[model samples]
Target: MCSNLQKAMIDLIEVFHSYSGKEGDKYKLSKEELKTLLQNELSGLMAESKDPAVVDKIMTDLDENQDGEVDFQEFVVLVAAVVVACHTFFEDLDKGNVTPCSRS
Candidate 1:
C-alpha cells in the first residue's frame, strides 16, 4: 500500500483533473472549473464562497501568467496555500488563539 502522504498526493491530482477539461485546455482549469472545484471540494473550508467575487479573486490571484486559466503548477500553489491555511487554523485553535465558531 502507498504511504499516507503518497495517497494524499494522488488524491490531489485526481481532484484537480476531476474539475478540469470541461470546456478547453485539458491540462488546465478554466475559471469556471476552478470555481466548481473550490465549491465542490473546499466548500466547508471556503465558507466565504457566498461572495461571487471570491472565485474571481482566486482566479486572478492564481493565474500568475494572466492567461485566464490555472495550470497544474498554479493549481498546486492554491492547494498548498489552502493546506497551509488549514494548518494554521488548526494550530491556532489548538492553542486557544482562534475560535472556530467565531463569526468572521
Candidate 2:
C-alpha cells in the first residue's frame, strides 16, 4: 500500500490534471480552470476569503513565468504554500498561541 504522504502526492497530481486542459493547454491551468479547481475542490478554503479579487490575485501570484497560465511547477508552488500555512497554523495551535476559532 502506498504511504500516506505518497497517496497525498498522487492525489494532488490527479486533482491538478483533472482541472487542467479543459479550455486550453493540456499541461497548464488557465484562469478559469484554476478558479474551477479552487471553487470545487477547495470550497472551504475559498469560502473563507471575502475578497472578490482573490482568484485574480492567486492567478497572478502563481503564474510565476507571467505566461498567463499556471503550469505544474507553478501549481506546486501554490500547494506548497498552502501546506506551509497549514503547518504553521497547527504549530501555533499546538503552542497555545492560537485557537481553532481565531485562525483568521
Candidate 3:
C-alpha cells in the first residue's frame, strides 16, 4: 500500500496527465490546458486572485523555457511554489499572525 504522500504524488501525476495530452502536445500543457486545469482543479486558489491576468502571469512564469507550454518540470515548480505559499499561510495562521476571519 502506498503512503499518503505517495498517493498524493500519484494523484498529482494523474491529474496533470488528465489535463495534458488533450491538445497538441502529449506531455506539455498549452495555455488553454493550464487555464482549464487551474479553473477546474484549483478553483479556490484561482478565485483568490482578482486580476484577470493572473492566468497569463502564471503561464508566463511557469513556462520556463519560453516554449509556450508547460512541461512536467515546469509544472512541478508551480506546484512547489503553491505548496510553499499554502504552508506559509498556514504557518502564519497558526502563529496568529494572520486573521482567519474578520467578523463584520
Candidate 4:
C-alpha cells in the first residue's frame, strides 16, 4: 500500500501537470512560474487557515534556502502539506466529527 505521503506526492504531481498544461513535462519549474502557479491554483487549499498571514507564513516556510521562491522539492513539500490537511479534513467528515460542508 502506498503511504499517505507518497499518495499525496502523486496527487500533487497530477495537479501540477494539469496546471502547466504539460502532463508529461517533468521539467524543472522556474521560481516565478512556481510562485504564480501556487498563488493561482493553490490559493484555496493554502488559504484554508482563513488567515492571509498564516498562508503567507506557510508559503515562506516552504521556501527553504531563502531563495524567495520554491523549487520542485519545496513545491512537493507544500503540496504534501496541503494534501495532509485535505485528508485530515475529509477524515474528520467521514467520522462525523465535522459539519457537512462544501467549499463551492
Best by TM-score: 3
Worst 10 residues of 1 by lDDT: 43-52
In model 3, where is the ten-residue run with the lowest total lDDT?
95-104
lDDT of 2 by residue, 1-104 (tens): 99999999999999999999998899999999999999998788899999999999999999989999999999999999998998998999899998887446
**TM-score between model 3 and native:** 0.92
Tens digit per residue, CA lDDT, model 4, 16-100: 6545423233444444455567678876654555664764575578778775545567777876776798899889988989885
Kindly list the per-residue Cα lDDT of model 1 for residues 36-76, writing each as its tens digit.
89878988866855676988998999999999999999999
TM-score per prediction, in order, is 0.90, 0.91, 0.92, 0.57
Off by over 4 Å in 2: 102-104
Point to the candidate with the largest lDDT: 2
Candidate 3: residue pairs that collide: none
Output the better candidate (1/4) by lDDT.
1
lDDT of 2: 0.94
Candidate 4 residue-wise lDDT at 72: 67
RMSD of each: 2.6, 2.3, 2.2, 5.6
